[model samples]
Each structure stands twice: as structure tokens, then as C-alpha cells.
Target: MKFPNPHYPNLRYPNRRYWYVPILSALLLLLNGGVNLALMRPLTDVPASMDKLRFHLDDAVFSLFFLLAAAVFAGAFSVLRRERGYLYLSFFSLMASQQFFWEWDGKHLLFGDFPVLPAESLAVKSGMTFAAFLFFRYLQGTNRRLTDRIFIYSAGGVWAMSVISSISPLASPLLPFLSGALLAIVLAYLLLAAGRFAHRFRRYPEDSELRLIVNGFAVFAILILPDVGKDVLQVLTGQRLGYLPVFWEACLEDTFPWALMQLIFVFGLLFFRRYMRVLEQNREAHAEIRTQHESLKQEVAIRQHMDRLLDALSGSYRLKDLEHTLVAEGRRLFEPHSFHWIPYNRKARSIDNSIDNPGLDSGELRELEELLFAADHGLVPGEILPGSKFAPVFIGVMGREELYAAISPKGRPLLERERFALQLLAKYGALFLDYYAMMEKRISELERYHGEQPWVGKLFMQMAEKERKRLASDLHDEVLQELLAARRWLEGSGSADDPMPAPERMRLALDNAEFMIRETCAELMPSFLSEHGVIHAVLKLADKMRVRADFQLEVRTGTLAAKLDDDLSLTVYRIVQELLNNAWKHSGAARVGLDMDQEAGEIVIRYADDGKGMDAEAAGMSPDRFGLRGLNERVRLMGGSASIDTRPDEGFRAECRLPLKRTATAPA
Candidate 1:
């Protein structure tokens, strides 16, 4: 027996080409009928026994029928190892084999009476009937719920009528006719189911598996008519002798089996092909999953390292630690070569920050300075100079003229995340030195005023403000750009099979990040302050608070005074900021007002809010809260005095007086 070919997963099969399989099967059926009739014409005088022995065509053809059934079973098993479609097909092959043996017994020897057992023959016929029913039941489209019920009822009606006929001889004649009608009904419905299957997959004509199924069933329906109707046709035209019809009669039984076998073969191929496709898809899916999982792991590790580094950089601020911390952070971020401070003394090879390296010899140091300065660092340190060999970023101070240290990253254009982190270190490095800005030119003033830990707290808060600004800038440049690019890729070119559903959600997240960064940057350093000085900064802060706190704020800063220095300007802004927070949080103020002016070469800032008040003396003892105590501490550090006046029923008021020593040439 032959078997259907095992499907090659890579082999392409076009459904359009497979339409020929059914067409050829139909043509062969007609050809078989015509040939049999022509051959039988000249053998009218020979006995049926002699006719069988003389021409082996009928014998050879029946043998092929058995092979075709085997092929069909093989094909069904190829698709799914456990699918019942193959099990049902096994039954069909058995029936075909039984029929072949029945023919063999009849034609065993000349004039031989080699009859099959009555019970065995009856069993084979019954088995074939059930197998055909199951074939219709299990195929994809024919197995629909409503369709299965119809098949069951139709088979049941045929069975009940046959049993009734067996119990009474008088009704036995109608049994054959009833069985024929039921068979016709079953075949008709099978054709309808096949047609519906084809219709459903019409748009997907390249699907060869589905095409084979539809076309194979169509061939079965086409051959079933002539094969089942031959007896009726012969009886109805019994007296009319026609050679062509007679030969066709001789061929019907032979031709129908071939058509049926061919249909089964097609079905087997379809199933096998479907199974191969499933395996390929599973492999591809697994590969994709592994790639995504590895990528996720790497991202998690990078983020953890970044978080740890950022925490370390933001928290530490000692003057001695700044140079070392800045250089170390750069090396971690960019992996640069030879991180050492640029020396100050005329001929010392050792750098100013005390880290000695042979790479920066006196002559080499001068050459390095010239190269770094020309590379766009603008004479201040912490400038990253990208070099093809030995990328060196400067992080410590250089040149004797400048008192503060300079930090530099020596590398060729660090990665986006690395550059962002290094820039943060540089921004704070500059501000950390400014914590001892008084020691630079006015060391005497520091000795004159002592506010204890309050002075240290003010420096810490100032450094914190610098960090906030740096972080906001980094988010805007690095994270925001990447998110927008990712969004555009998803919108323009993402595949439909992608797991992430909506590009719009990424867009919404991007918009939210942008807004948050903008607000943070503005809060850290008001845009209006640098351009229009402290007056506008106060007005803008109040305008924003009016909307947020639902309060009214009035500011007055009209008096004779020179432009203030950055220290006094930031100090005044923070004083007013602290007072506003107290009024809104503690006082529950609906109306708050602030007034600032210089009196006796002094800067005065006084603010009051209409809200519930607290004891001024009691509030001063509260520690760690940036309130009245903090305001007074800030005032005392700048050689100034702070006063808070409040009562239970009346509003809240905070006043600060600081001597502003600034020349007209100073830039605020």
C-alpha cells in the first residue's frame, strides 16, 4: 500500500495549482468508464470469468484503490500524531482492503465459486458506512455543532429504518430504497459543508491545506452520483440497448473507488502541512521570548547601577571629597583612562588634588591644558574631551588663577546616560566650592558672622537646588529624546504582532515626563530671576502659588539699593519661599503678602499671611522643619537678623534684615 508523502515545512505549495488534483481525478473517473465499456464490447460472447482473466486492468485498478486509501491514512497521521481524523481514516482503508479481497475471491480461478463470508461482507459494508460519517464529523468546518447534530440524526434515521425492515420481511424491499435516499442526503450535506469551507477561506487562496480539503470533497460529491445511480439508470432504461452506457455501467464501480482514494490523499496532505506550520511558529515564538528576556535583564542591571551612583553623587558635598568623587564617578560612567587633577605649581608633575601620575609631566601638563582648552571646556574643568586614544575627562581644578577645582571627563563623546551623569557631578562640583565662596575673597567676613549648624544647612540646601536643576536638564535631554524616538518608531513601523498594544500610552507618558521636568527646572531656578532679578522671581512664585493655594499675594520691593549679589539674591528668595510655605501649610492663609527693600545699606524681607497663627517663640524651637527657625538661621548666617510675629487670632508675619554689600558693577 502507498502512503501520502511527508510534508516538507520549507516546501511551498500553492492552492491554485492543487485545483488540478480534483480535476484530474474527475477526468480519470470518466476515462475509466469509457475504456471499460469499449473493451467489454468485443468480449460479449466471453463469459464474465474469461473477461476478468483476459484483461488484468480491473485487477490492477482495484489494487491501486487499496494503495490510495493507505496514502490517505498516512497523510492524516502526518499532520497531528494524536488526531482522530487519522484513526477514522484507518477504518476507511480497512474497508477498501476488504472490498479488494472480495473482488479477488470472486475472480480467484476460472469458474471458481470463491465467495466471501456473509457476515464478513456485511461487517465491511457497515464499517464503511460509519467511517464515511466520521469523515464528515471531524473535518474542520464539517465538525460545527449544528452540522454534527444534523449528521447524527440523519444516520440515526437510516439505522432505525434498517432495523425495522430486519424485523419484518414484508418491509424488506423498501429498506434498500430507504438506505439509498439516506446516502444521497448525507452526500449532499457533505458537499454543502465542503463548499462552505472553501467559501470561508476564499480570501486566503494561498492556503493549500484548506484548498485540498474543499476540492477533495468536491470530487467525492461529483463521483458519488454516477457510482450510486448506475443501478437505477440501468433499470429505468432496461429495454434501450446502448454500448456506451453499458460500458459506463461496467466502469462506475471501478472509477468511484479511485476518486474516493484521491480525495483522501488530498486530505492527508492538508493535515500534515498544518502540523509542520505549528512547529515552525512555536520555534519562532520561543526565540523571540528569549531575546526579550535577556534585554530586560541587562536594562535592570544598568538602572540599578545608575541609581546607586546617583545617590552617592547627590548626597556627598565635602570640599576634599568633591574632586575624588567627581573623578571616580566619571571613570565608572565612561571608563576613561588616567583620571588625575591638572596641577597648579609651575614645574610639579604631581596634580593639585594630590593624585600623582607620570602621564601629566610638567611639559605634558602644558600640552594637555592647551588641548583640553581648545576642545570646548571653556577654561573651567569638568570638560569632557573625546580622544581617539586614552579618553581623559578632567574633573579637578587647573591653572593657578582660579581658586576652585575643575572636573573633566576625558573620553570621545560619552554615551547619553554617561554624559548626563558626568554633567551632574560637574554642576555640583562647582556649587560645592561655592559653599566656601566666603573663604575665597572675604575670609574675614566668615569669622565675623557665625550661625553654627544653620550656616551648614543653608549650604546643603543650596547644593540640593543645583542638583535639582541638573536632574531636570538631564531628563529633558536624554530620557525625553529616547522616549520620543521610541514612540515614533512604534507609530511608523511597528509590527501588528507586537506585544505592547498602544503607542498613544507611550506618548502620554512622554508628555507627562516633559511637563514634570519643566516644572522642576522652573522651581529650582526661576526663569524670571536671572533676567529681571529677585523682584520678578517673587512675583512669578506668588502668581503660581495663587493658582495652586487659592490665595492672593502682593509684593513690594521699592527702595534705594544697588543690585544684589547672587548670595543675597538667593538668600532673600529662600526667606520668602520659607515664609510662604509656613503660611500655606501652618497658617491656612487665603491672603499672603511680602515686602522687600534695603534699609541702612541693609536688605529687608517681610511677609505676612491672613491665617491661623502660632506662638512665634514656640515655632523657633522646632528642628529639621524649614520654617521660622530655618528662616532665622538663614538670616543670622548672612550677618542679618530674623523676626517672626504671630498670635492666635491675628495673621502671620516674618521679617528679615540683611546688609547688602554689592557694587553697581556686580551682576546678579
Candidate 2:
């Protein structure tokens, strides 16, 4: 609801009782009551003229009171803004206007001397009483449809009787009876109102204001009904109850109207006080409800924004795409000037510097990094470091490692709520970045693996070919020469055309060729691998490593399957051989452990060494490190994934999972 004032949140009214208003109203009523007694009782010899004694002491008091009541009701009509108020105003104004006419004639004012006839006095009473009937029902909040029909018809009949009496003297006898009937209707309505208030008083017994209002109404009804009964009795019986009758008339004239005014004044003041207090309370309640509604709207928007951000981040593998999305969404809320990124490692730079911040140079970015590292305060606002352009910075971390961002907002600093949102975004952004980086690294490694597949294949084939050619050269140059010489010696011993040769020399040349052929067979393909399985071959290599390299090699094969395929076994042998070669050449420590397991159609190998490990990025797949690169290629060719974790001081650990289960045919 719109308030009484649009800007002010609450309404203030003069609700505290104006105690003197009712007291003054009562005093005026008593003064008028005194005037009524003086005018009616002391003037026993007064003329009973049709147009005399209208203006007198009672007339002057009536005018003063009517004028005051009219003023009060008119103000009430303005403030109450109810039709019931209008009804009271109409009644009071009619009474006041009638009394004013009684004090003033057509041309001049008359006080204490104006004249009145019985018919004229009766007409005035008829109008004032009609207004009172309407006011009484309206003030009680009664159902007025039936009452309206009854009162209107009754008043009309009374007036009709009065009109007939004015036209013909014969109808004058019925006037008192009609007046008594009208007064009876008013009295009945007052009794009904009193009964309703009494029922409410019983329902809410502790309500002090209600109790006061009910008491006033009860007092008014009791006092006013006595006047109605006395007047009705005189009209019906034509027998005046003369003893103590004047005492009753004086009490009716003085106390009757005063009781009615007392109830009306108290009820009105009390009702207005409660109404204003309720209005103020409603104003506060509506304000709180609106504030809560606004907060709920903000929270919903924040949740939707977070959902959108997560959607953008889910599939974003590149840092640049993620950066662009961050800028766009951050612009929606914060409108920062630019978004800059820096790496924890000073060497690695921002993914998008030229696009996000065109003029910012690398030197400034490094300085920002320095300032962040040197900042003493935590992540609350107003914790700016000296010589820092960023007023608020949100740091992101992954595990123990820290990542960086300059985050120089364009204009003013972020609000506390915005900073909190940014911190949330930054944390999730860092986590997603780590995930994307891992994926990007794997993709690059697979690319390098594929690219090197053919080259690694060619290099191994070239080495095998070179080894075979060297064996062929040795057999041709030395073994063939010895055999030819032994043949010549045999030919010389057999005939005169052959050169001189002994039987012992021929036997020695044959022995030398046999030994050279055995050495070539061993170099080309070890016979031990063909005779034994992959496990035996690996244990043999460990034995050789223990005897020759002084390395403690422990091997576990509890989960390894028996009877590996020829190709698989060859691949495993080469892998173990290359691992040992790298461990012996690069690693200076003496301990190595290898665990081989084949479970549920997959081959898993875990190799670890307590050795001086090398830089992982530098040594894993570098050009010079052909051993690890070749081992990775061999695993890739078998359709597998390989990972090597190494640090400078920590031990090197390598794991390879290869799908090498053989059924009808080996996997391509």
C-alpha cells in the first residue's frame, strides 16, 4: 500500500489523547444543560406563542455546542477517510446549522429572545433525530440494508403524519404517538449496539481500550434510555407521573447528551491511536520483506552466473580461450579494464598479453609478480602493496605450487562481494587450468611419440643392419681367409699342386671359423631368450648387472603370466634392457626395483630406482636421451601408456601399462 507520504517510511499522528477536548465538550454540554433548565423551569408565565421564545439561554448554548461539534466532525471526515465519518459529520453539521438558525432570524441576530411555535420546534426535532438515527447505525458498523428501509419508511410516515397535522387540526392528536414511535426505533438500535460491544468485551476481557469503550457505550445507553422511556410514557397514557417528574426531566436534560458525547469522544481518539500504530508497523514489515526479496534475487543471479562460468571452463583446453571467457564474464559484473596473467615461474609468460592488455610490457608484468611475492597482507581488500597497480588481487594455487595473475582492474577497486566472487572464480580457474595443462602435456607427448615412431624404427633397424654388416665383414675377411688357407693346406697335403700345409693347421682354421660364427649368432639374437621365457631373460640381465655394474636389482613377477607371446616377450626384454642401461649410465645410485604384473588382459610394469634422478622435462623425451624415448616408443607400439616421474634429488619411477593379452591374434 502507498503510504501517507511517499518519502517517509512511517506515519505519525497526534494519537496521544487530547484530554481537554472531551473535558471541554462535557463542560459545554453541562453549561447548555443549565441553560435548558433556566429557560424551561423559571419562565412559568411565558407566552405559548407560535413564534416566540425561540432564541434564549438554551438556544445560545445549543448554537455554541453545535458549531464546535461540526468543526470536530469535519476534521474527522478529513482524517478518517471513511463514509461512516461522513455520516457523523452530516449529523453534527445539521444540528449546528439548525441551532444557528434558532439564534439568528432572517435579518438580525437574536440571543435569549427568539420565538418558536410547537410545530416549528417539532419540525426541527424531526430533522435532528433523523440524522442521529443514521449516525448511530453507521458508527456501529451494522448491516444497514434492513435498517435503511425500516428507518426511511418510518421517518417518512412520521413526517407524513406531521404534514397532515400541519394541514388539519384534527390530525394533531396523532403527532405525539408518531414522535414516540420514532424515538423507540432509535432506542432499539442503541440497545443492539450495546449488546454487540458487550459480547466483544467478554471475548477479549483483558483489552483495556475495548473495556473503556464498552463501558462508555453502556453508560450512554443507560442514561439516554431513561429520557426515551419518560417521554414515551407521557405520550401514551396522558397521565403525567407528577411526583419527582421534574427531577427526572432535569436529569435527562443535563446528563443524557453529556453521556453520549463522552463515549463518542473516547472511542474516536482510541481508534485513531491504534490505526496509526498499525500503519507504522505495516510500513516496517513491508520494508523488511522487500529487502529480503532483493537479496534472494542477487543469490539466484550469482548461482546462474557460476553455472555459466563452469560450462565455459569445462571444455576449454587452451588457456587463451579460458582467458577470453574470464574477461567477458568478469566484464559483466566487475567491468575491470583488463585481465592479465602471469606464471609462478617468471620465465613462463602470460598466455594472452597483447589482446587483453595491449600496452602492458613484460617488465611491468614481472614487477607485478614481484609485488605479489613481496605483499605482506592476506586477501582482503584495502591491502594494497606499495608501487602496486592492483588494488585487489586473488591468488590461485595448485597443491603446494603457486600460480600467478596480475589482475589489474581498470578503474576503481572491486567491492567486497565482487572480490569474493573473483576469489571463487580464481580458485576454480586454477584447478581447471591444472587439468587442461595435464591434458595438453599428454597430447604433446603423444604427438612427439607418433612423430618419432618412424624415426625410432629406422634408427634401430639401421643399428641392426650395421651390426649384421660388421659380422659379415669379419666372417669374410678373417674366417673365410682361414678356411681358404686350411683348404689350401689340405689341397697341398693331398697333391703336388697344393701349397705346403700341416693337418694341425687345417684343424685350427676350422676351429677359428666355428668360434667366429658362434659370436655372430650371439650378437645378432641372444640364444638364451629363444631357449627361456621373458622372466628368465630379465633375471639373467639382473645377474649380469649385479656381477658387472655392482647394482642391487630386485625383480617381482608374482602377477606375471606364463608363456608370453614372442613379440611381447621381445618388447619386454628390450624395455628392461634399456631401463638398466639408463640407470647405469645416468643414475649413480645402486638400488633398482622392477615389478611386472599381467592382470585382466593388461600388462603393467613398475620400475623404480633410488638414484640421482634427472630433470623430467629435460631428460624424458629429449633428443639426446634416446634410451627413455625409445622405451616410450616401444610401449606405444604395443598400444600402451607410459609415465615417468623424476626429480633432481628424489628417486626416478617409471610405469607402463600395455594391453598385450594374446588370443586368436595379437592386437595391432
Candidate 3:
């Protein structure tokens, strides 16, 4: 009766123990059976006039026993299974058992001379009608109509009449009529239930449960028709219908069918139990499949968004175009109520206010700056600005040089997938921004170079001529004269010397010429750099500068320095050489520091000197200051950035960030 549900294995009955209900029902049935048996008398003792209607005592006893047993079991099943339909069947059986016990010869078997109370009979009939109504309602499955309301009111009237008749002897005569009315109402309800079930069975012929219920109700309604007819005849004629004798005779016609109906209902309950388990499992399987489907769809959507962001990164050529792409994609991804791309001014050290957006005003901009500053110059997630409706997600692009802020339109937090997409978009957008900045600087430099082509060409030719004359002068004055002197010494050494040995003089002369040639080549380019790498070359340059300027120089390099391209290595060496020369000649620095490292696919170089610095703008414009101009040109040609921070009486500092390119042998 309390079987475990496969879908919900932990399900338990209301009571932990299982034996009390059946035991209690058994005790009650035993007491009722004992009382009925004590009141029963032998068939021979019955009056001769009632012989035609009297049933065998043994047969009567067996029928009563069967009915009572069915009643007890039905009640126990109803309690254990928690089903209302079986409870109603139990009530019907108990009422039928009582009718069989007392209806012998229309009176109690042992008290034939005693007067009968019509109130008691009316009470019993009302209870039977109530039980029938509940059972039919359960079969109907929560659907109620006007007829049900009428049956309810009629049952209420009969109960009220029975109560009145028991309280006052004067109301006894009306009890018979009340009982007739209740019986008619019960009969009509039964017929209606049978008809409804029949219609349902016809429509759903494949449903075995409906077929069983339909047959049970039809048999019950047909068996009760004879009794309803007998009650009508007695009430209309004002005399009992001897044609349909009351007592065990009447029960004999209906008892077996009623018992069969009870069995049908019990079997139906078993079928319903199995059906519910299967239905629950099917529902769970469908729910699990739906969850998996949703997960797969979300994964595909995230991948598509990433692909689109990658395309935008490669396709956009200008900062404005990239900004538009970011705003459009943000709206599609987040469906934000407001989106803005706020640019930051590095020189001003604040957000740019010249460009205006709808949602962010000057006050909001200041608050956003404060928030970024409070977050240690990094972006904060889901931060609410002053007077904003929802917390907006802020993404810092290109190291906070630009910001993308979006607020969800639904005024809720972003999902994890949406947040991840936004982060990726910000990262790719930063790369495009860096690319566009480099392109703009290159284009501007090209335009300036084109404008000054005539002057620059002539200046370069003059410098080349001046450099060639200087090289010739150094060769003539040092290497050329030394070689000629060495040749003369060798020629003269063939003859005898007057005071010193010719071999020692010739070896000395040859060594001096070789030394002069090596010095000339070192001025052209350091041979140590091409042989050893940039790191060692820089160290050698630092050693020479340290002694020449009498200043302490510190140099640091990372592992990435070993992977630099030959061209890039030379560029680095030249930039370091020029910076040191500038510091020694102009800054007169006491101490200098140089740092080389790699970050985010770029080689970073930082140089500083503790010396009296110059006005950077003024020094750049000076015609004689080719060292600073050439340093800027070298960085610019390599698609790198160089920034110098110096003022009069302050230390000079220069930082250069050069993008690393992938080589066949080295990873980028």
C-alpha cells in the first residue's frame, strides 16, 4: 500500500510505522461481526407469514461475513494508500452490511415485536447517499457542474431532516418521505455518473483504466434500480412492497455485484500507481534533455561572439571605426540601456571632456575617474555611477586610455558568458587601438618628411660629404702615415742599423699600424655587438661610458633580449649608445640606469640619468642636436613609441616600447 516511488525514492508515509491501521480496522470489524452474530436467530423461529421472504441463516451469515471482510480491507487499503475513492467504497460497504443485518422481515431478527425508529433508517440512507456522491465525484476528477450542486443540496436536506426526526418524535412521520427523496437523488446521480463514464470510454477505447471504471459504475447503477423502484412503490401506496421483500432477500440480489465493484476499484488503484511512476520518469528524462540542449546553444553563441570580435579587430583601420564596432557589439551582446566610449587624455591625466555622450555628464565623468583612481588605475566590475539607474560594466581599453561602459537594460547583473565576451572584446579592441595610433604617427611623420624633402636631402648630402672628409682626414693623419712609416722602416730594416736592431723596430712599426686600423673600424661600428648579442654589447658600451663620464651606470636585461632580431639588436645598441652620449656630453650626469624587459609582446627599454636635464622641446628643435632627432627617428621607424621626461635642473628619463615581430625561429 505504501510502495516507494522510483522518481522519489526518499518518499515516506505520514506515519513511520505501517501495521497500526490494518490492526485497528480488524478490531473494529471483529466487534461489529460479533454484535451482528449475537443478534441473529434461527430461520425456523421466523413467523410463518414471512417464510416466502426468509433467507437461510447459514447463507445470511456467509454473505454478512463476506461484506464485512471487504469493508475492513477497503478501509485499510484507503488508509495505507491515501486514496479517497477507496475510503468512499469502504463507507458504502459498511452501510450495506448494516442494512443486511437489520432488514430481516423488515425488522431486527430478535426484536420483531419492538417498534422501529424511522429516524434511524433515514440516517442510514442519508449516509449511503453521501458516500455515493463522494465516490462519483472522485471518478469525475475535479470537474463539477450544476447537477453536483443540486445533489449536494438534496443530501444536506436529508441529513437535516434525519437530525430533526431524532430530536422530536412529532417529526417521525416526515422521515419516510425524506428517505425516499434521498434515495431518488442517489439513483439519479449514479445514472449520470455511469453515462459520463460511458461517453469517456467510447472516446478513449484504448484506455483500459477508463473501461474498468465505466463497467464498475454501470453495474452499480443497474443493481440499485430495483431497490429504488421498491422504495418508490412503498412511498406512493403508503404500504410496504411485498413484491420486493426487504432484508437479506434484497441484499442477496445486490451484494455480489457490490463486492465485484469494490474489487474493480482496488485493481484500478494498483494500475494508477504504476502509471504515475512511469509518467514521472518520462517527465524527468525530458527535463534533463532540455537542460543539455540549452547548454549547448549557449556555448555555440559564445563562440560566434568571439569570432565576430576577432574579425572586428583585424578589419577596423581607425580608432573611431573600432569604437563604433565596440559600441555596436556591446549593445548586441548586453542589450544595455546606455553605452559610451570615453577617451582619456594622458597629458591632462584625466578623461577627455570635449567629446560628449548622452548618459555620462561632466559630474559622472569625474566620479568615474575617482572610481578608477580608487581601484588603483584599473577597471572595476559592475560599478554604479552617481545618478545611474543600474550598475554598468566598465572596460578599460589600451591601459585606460579609453573606456567602454555599458549598463544592462533589464537593470540586473550580467551573466558570466556576457562578461567574458566583453572582456575579450576589450582586449582585442586595445590591440586595434594601439595599431591605429602607430599608423597615425607614421602617416604624420611621412607627411612631414615629404614636405621637407628638398631641405632634408641637401642636409643629408652635406653631412655625408662632411663625414667622408673626416674619415679621410683620420686615415691620412693616423693609419696612412703609420703604414708609410712602417713600410720605410721595413725597407730600411733590410740594411744594417746604426744603433738599434732592425727586427725590433720593424715589429714595433707593424703593431702600431694594426692598432690604428682597429681604432678606425671601432669608430665605424663596434665589432663586439655583431659577434656577441645586444646584451653583451650594451654592457661593453656601459663600461666605456662609465669610465669616460666617471659616473656609475646600472644595466638590467631579461631573457627576451637573447631572442632579438639582428636588426632590432643593432637598433637597441644604437639607441643606448646615443642616450649615453647625450647624458655625458649635455646632462653631465653622475649616475645612470638602464632597464630592458619584455611585456605583452613588446620589448621595453627605460633609461634615466641623475644630471641637470635640458628643455626637451627646445633641444629637439635645435639644428645641431642630431643625436635626439636620430633617436626619435630610429624608434619611429620600428613602429615603437619613445617618450622623454626631462626639465632644466631635473634628471633626464627616456622610455621606449618596441613591438616584437615573430621570426621563423623565435615565438612572438
For each candidate, give its TM-score against the true structure: 0.42, 0.39, 0.33
Q: CA shift at 431, candidate 1, in angstroms?
A: 15
Which candidate gets the maximum lDDT versus the true structure? Answer: 3
C-alpha local distance difference test of each model: 0.60, 0.62, 0.63
Total residue pair clashes for candidate 1: 20
lDDT of 3 by residue, 276-300 (tens): 6546766998999998898779878
lDDT of 1 by residue, 445-484 (tens): 3444433335655645754664565576667675677577
For residue 478, model 3's alpha carbon misses the true position, in angstroms, by 48
RMSD values, in order shown: 24.7, 22.7, 22.7
Show pairs that collide, candidate 2. 52-115, 52-116, 53-115, 54-114, 54-115, 55-113, 55-114, 56-112, 337-410
- Please identify model 3 stretches exceeding 4 Å from their true place: 1-82, 105-115, 143-150, 153-157, 167-177, 221-668
lDDT of 2 by residue, 1-668 (tens): 11112223243343233354445545544554555555555444655441244324344454566667667666766765643545465465556456455534421333244444434445555566566656654544443468655775676566566656656778778878877876786667567656766776576565555555555655565556656687678889998743232433454553444554555566556545555666777798999989888867766777677788889888676877776776666556454455544334323422324445543567866566566666553443223334555543444443343444445555676454655566666666766766777777777876776686677556566545644665788689867888887887778744554453477677887998887677556534656776877778778777767765667888887546556677787888778877876777688767999888787778788899999898977556776565677688778777777999999978789998778654332222
